[model samples]
Target: MSTVATAFADSSIMLRRNVKHTLRNPTTMFNAVLFPIVIMLMFVKVFGGAFSVGEHYIDYATPGLLVMAVSYGLGATATAVNDDMTKGIINRFKTMDVSRGAMLTGHVVVTTVRCLVACAAIVGVAFAMGFDPEASALDWLGVLGLFVLLAVGASWLTVAMGLAAKTTESAGLATVPLIMLPFLSSAFVPADTMGAGVKQFAEYQPFTPIIETLRGLLAGHVSQGDAIAAVAWCVGFAVLGYVWALSTFKKRA
Candidate 1:
């Protein structure tokens, strides 16, 4: 096999290992899926009345919830990477001649998959709560594509953070920004509704463009500017994460 083919094959092996680990310890999936659902319920039922977005609040909130869902389970990804590094699993893989790239690929791919599944669950619950969208099939494709891009970027970044941290506990702490950024973005309320400093931060932050793009796609009126900004941010993140992860792996592994 060519070198690229070998790397892919090794990544597949690592992917299987991670998948089995997730299955055996199902708490990760449970937390990823359940917490988003609970949050969706709270926003739609308890706090929906407080927002005035001129539409069914569920519809308005669903896109933001989906974006937030992407961030929910990522702490585990950082911790998992940190665990492998600290526990010497990477050494074992090296001794076995496993491609270092494949090891990182395995973690990132599993994380993206996990995020997508959680997003799907959130959408299902959203629909059940009268969260109707105006998206066409093409629009749905855009949403899914954008989501995959965001998840891939976020996963790579988390993997890098995992490799950088000195301990699993610190790794978990490092990922708080991933979980918290959506809240500080245009996810829960309009950016303009926030106070002065916060509003400026929210409008300018990375997640805001991404969330706005998602909201537009779901509403079938996506702004071209937001879409461009969103894609640019995701690509920038993915590149940054991949470089940071590989460099760290070389030093630490």
Candidate 2:
């Protein structure tokens, strides 16, 4: 096999290894999937009425929660990456002449898949809770595209975090900001409803544009500017994270 083909083959093996680990370790599933479902239920059942946003609170909240779900699920990826680094797995791979990039690629791909699955769960729960979207076929496509982009970008960033941490615990802790940033955005409430400083911050923060773009796509009235901003942010994250991850892996792995 050519070098590129060899790399792809090795990466596939690594991906399967990670998937098996995810299956055996239900805690990762709990963190990536179940926890988000519980949070969605709480928001819709417990606090939906108080934070009414023009439409059924579910409609307004689903987009934000979807982003939140993606953000929240990434901690598992970071810790998993850290585990491989700290557990002598990298040393074994080195001895085996495995494509160095394959290991990280496996983590990134698995993380993205986990995020997609978590988002699907959030959407399913939203539907059960009467969350309705007026999105067109094209709008749904846009939403899917955005979801993939966000997942890939965030996965790369988390992989980099995993590579940089000295321990799995710290790797998990490094992702706290990822889990918390959505709360500061227009996820549950409109940025405009926030106080002065917070409102300004929420409006310009990366997550806000992404959430707003999603909200618009779902509502059938998305702004062009917000869509552009959201795409740019995703691309920026993917680039930054890819570079950071590759460099860190080279240095530390």
Local distance difference test, candidate 1: 0.91
Question: Model 1: residues >4 Å from true position, as ranges?
Answer: none
The Cα local distance difference test for each model comes to 0.91, 0.91
lDDT of 2 by residue, 27-87 (tens): 9899888898888888888988899588899998889888987898888899999999999
Candidate 1 clash pair list: none
Model 2 stretches astray by more than 4 angstroms: none
Q: Specify the poorest-scoring 10-residue window by lDDT in model 1.
A: 24-33
Candidate 1 per-residue lDDT over residues 1-253, each given as its tens digit: 8999999999999999988887777778876678888888898899889998888888888888888888888888899999999999999999999988999999999988888888989898888888789999999999999999999999999999999999999999999998989989888789988998999999988999999999999999999999999999999889999999999999998
